[model samples]
Target: MEKRNQSAITEFLLLGFGDLHNFKILVFTLFLIVHIMALTANVLVIVLVGVTRSLHSPMYFFLSQLSLSELLFTSDIVPNMLWLILVGGGRVSVARCIAQFHILCIPSAAQCLLLAAMSFDRHIAICRPLHYATMMTVTRQLQVVTSCWLLGVILALFLYTFLRKLQFCDLNTIDHFYCDVAPLLQLSCSSTCTVELAVAMVTYPLLLSPFIFIIVTYICIIRTILKIPSSTGRHKAFSTCSSHLIIVCTYYGTLTFIYLFPPTDNSIELHKGLSVLYTLVTPLFNPLIYSLRNQEIRAAIFNYIQSFKKWKAEK
Candidate 1:
């Protein structure tokens, strides 16, 4: 009898919605436009925060950090994605897959934690206005920022370690646009029970804790709003929270659907589209949705333009 040989697989192909027949160019062009917008929006927020001295408070400080993280978050997915579509390529090396997974996971988990921290800031600012200054000092801000990223790093590593240990036998196609863990698990050769249970045990609390705090913060915020004698004051308070609420909902709603519910084929297809909204579109819109509509930001823009003109004339 001839000796039989078995070889270990070194890479996996990402099926990525499995190539639309003729929509490659159209999709690439559309994504390019969105990519440009995403970069521009995120960069604008970062730059504005850098140039403005008055925006040095905790809120803007966190916003700037969120903008930076969002920029990273989108960069990790969009470029490689556009290339895959444009070239009609879906192949990715095992090493590259793990690397991409790591980069995307870190910033995402960090932002989730950062958003939670921001909610706490809101709670302190609104609920205990007098103590807000002392509670959210620069030292506390640094501590919170450090804790957010460190905690994220620890949690993401826990998931990634198990995910990387998964053995792949035959399947390589990913149903979604990006390398998400659940869809990847469907391709694993290992008993995914351990991974699934570990994942849920770890991730459920990470997702829920922030949402719980956000709920509590908003409850307090609404109470404070109601206490205001003037209707205008109440409207303004509601408006202030509204933009953040829109962003939080858009981000978390799609994410919950992806992770909490089981991934049916239909839901997988739905998730691909919706993931674009949450991962790429929502982050870009955050600065715009929250700040562009604000009168203060509008006034700042006007003042910036005037200052630029005056400096040009003086020169």
Candidate 2:
């Protein structure tokens, strides 16, 4: 039987943009450019936040780590994606696919928790300013960050164990650009009801829980901002929170669209597009949003640029 032969399959072919034969070169070039920009921007944020002492608050600290998560998240998939496009086809061993999936899940889950933690930081900073120093101390920041990563890893491993038990048949073509859960599940020979249930159970905690936490934190922050007597004070408070809000919306919106919707043949393309939005576009835009919209980040970047120029002139 066909099911018996499934065990011999060693790899899966990733049909990454293969349908765009006419625009193959164009697609490859565009993705390559954006991937480079995303990497540069995230790395810059990480370095600037670490070296710039003036930017050393719990808020910036979370932003830096978020950027780091984004960097690792994109790196887990993008390089392989770009290479596939260059070669005009992509082949990934089962082991490599599983590794990519695990690596991808870890960062994705961490970012969700990290975003929630950032929202909490903002809430404490604005809603409870008197207690901010005691509540969000350096030790507390470390604990929050550690918890984010540890929770992410634990959830990822938990889901991964269940996923490995599913039987993958001879169908080796993944319709997406990366080795993602939906596409991988589609290739399985076994009944996917249990896998889907496991996925939902795992994802709900990582996705919805953080999303709700963010909404609650932001609501509290907005209320606190509105309570300020002066219009100028309210504006200042809202401005501080706006950049993060934009990122949270974009990241979670596209992600929720992909995860919440069941993937069908008609909707696979849409899923890929939405995946690109969060995985690539969001990371690319995070640095731009923070740098251009936040006065402090802009100042730090300008000062760093000036120092670089001065060093070059002295050389």
Candidate 3:
């Protein structure tokens, strides 16, 4: 019985939307549209940032990096999710499941650190405008972005390496849409107490530390904005910072609940719904938010469109 159980789960069957089996086609169509739109939006942002000389600032630079990360992040999940929804249920090899889990965590962890760094960038720009140029030099901006990616990859690997050692026996059906650390661990037959502890320890510093840092930075930003007697200046300052704040709140708020809390059998469905907010909705809306909120982004997009039209006319 023990050997049979051990051999039972060489692959995982993702039970996606079992409750909505009747609406699989609709679900697949909706997801497909979202996936395409997300890719197009992020790619447009990347191109605009790269080509537009006027957008060559620290804020836009960080935004472009974020767009790139969002591209990879959604790519890691949506394609597989689309397939599963269209095909009803599908099998994923054990190795592929592990890889998927790692890929999902990489961009997410990077976004956490990147948002923190962006907050710091805004803090210096708004609070210490005099020294912003010297303090956040282009070289330093590159270094900060590099560190976000490096730290995210290193820490995600640490969690993945630890998870890889754990033995999964018999239980292989993942209840959620995709492979995630919590759901995967829940499927493990062995007691995951030690691994969970290690994950929690890493998760706190990665997620909460940056979150608290952002909060503190925002406090300083708000204070600085208030000191400006001119209401117009205050509105301008608020506009610049508000987008990041909105993105941060939306991304981190859901993430905190998902990662910081222990997963329970009762909350699996709830967790899955919340995961959609951060994983799909956040990335989907990021480009839209920036494009709509930032005048500079809008101007660049407008110029790019006009240039494309001229080129087509000439062709």
Candidate 4:
């Protein structure tokens, strides 16, 4: 019976916003623009960090890694989402769905850890400025970035293994746009107690712990900035981390609301809307936030533009 049930289901019907028949074209156009903007913004950050000597510090290095992660995260989910919006959702093979989940989870997990690391970088820059150079050396930066990605890969694999074990009987209709954990678990015919437990174990440490660390670090940072005596010094110190703080709040806030407080049937649409914020909007906002708020990034961009114009004139 179990074998037959498992064999009977091989695909899922993703009913993505099928009810919004009139707004399909509008939604598709908006998502396409956002997707292109996100890709362009992240790629610009990556290229600037790689080629620009001014952005060689630990902070910018982490920002570049973040852009790279956002690139992967957005690329994995957005195109499919756009397609679903255009077609009013469609069928996706079980294997393809699981693969999408794997790809999405990896970068999502990595970004959580990476944000924590960025907070630490800010903490050191503000709270322990004298030791910043020594603490955040090139080798240490590499280690931190490598660990985030490696742990992310491990976590994704662990979840994938458990997900593979679940049987998906006759019911395979997922109302959501993507293969998120909650929707997938709801569809599974097999017992999901173990999977839920595993997810909780991973989520608490990966999500909550980092969030707590960021909060604690910011508290210390705030206290230190307050003691700087000069208003200029305080403002400068606060500015260094303000962008990171904003991103952290937005990212963790949505994630907490989504994962910590599971959505009810009535709130599923709201849940999907919030998912779009972090998945689509956040990536577009990241580079913009940094570019607008960080003086160094703006200066770098301006210098590059001038240099490009000069080269063109010479040619």
Model 4 pairs whose backbones collide: none
The TM-scores, one per candidate, come to 0.92, 0.95, 0.95, 0.96
Candidate 1 deviant stretches above 4 angstroms: 1-7, 310-315
Cα lDDT tens digits for candidate 3, 103-168: 877888889989999999999999999999999899999999999898879988988888887667
Instruction: Give per-residue CA lDDT, model 4, range 1-315, as digits (tens).
Output: 123344558999998877667888888898899989999999999999999998999999999999999999999888888888887789998888988988888998999999999999989998888999999999999999999999999999998998888778878898888888888788787888999998888887888888989899999999989999999999888888889989998999998898887878899989999989989999999999999998888998999999999999999
Candidate 1 least-lDDT 10 residues:
1-10
Residue 127 shift from truth in candidate 3, angstroms: 0.5
Extract clashing residue pairs from model 1. Answer: none
List per-prediction Cα lDDT, in the order shown: 0.78, 0.86, 0.86, 0.90
Clashes of 2: 0
Q: Pick the candidate with the highest TM-score.
A: 4
Model 3 worst lDDT window (10 residues):
1-10
Ranking the candidates on TM-score from highest down gives 4, 2, 3, 1
**TM-score of predicted structure 1:** 0.92
- Residue by residue across 1-315, what tens digits does model 1's lDDT show? 121233446777776656667988888888789888988877877777778777778877787788888898899998888877776667787767877877787777778888878877877877688999989999999898888788877877888788888777666677666777776678776678888877897778878988888888888888988998999987877776777787788778877887788688767778778877876687778888856776665666678889999999999
Give the per-residue Cα lDDT of candidate 1 at 1. 17
2 or 4, which is superior by TM-score?
A: 4
Evaluated against the true structure, the overall lDDT of model 3 is 0.86
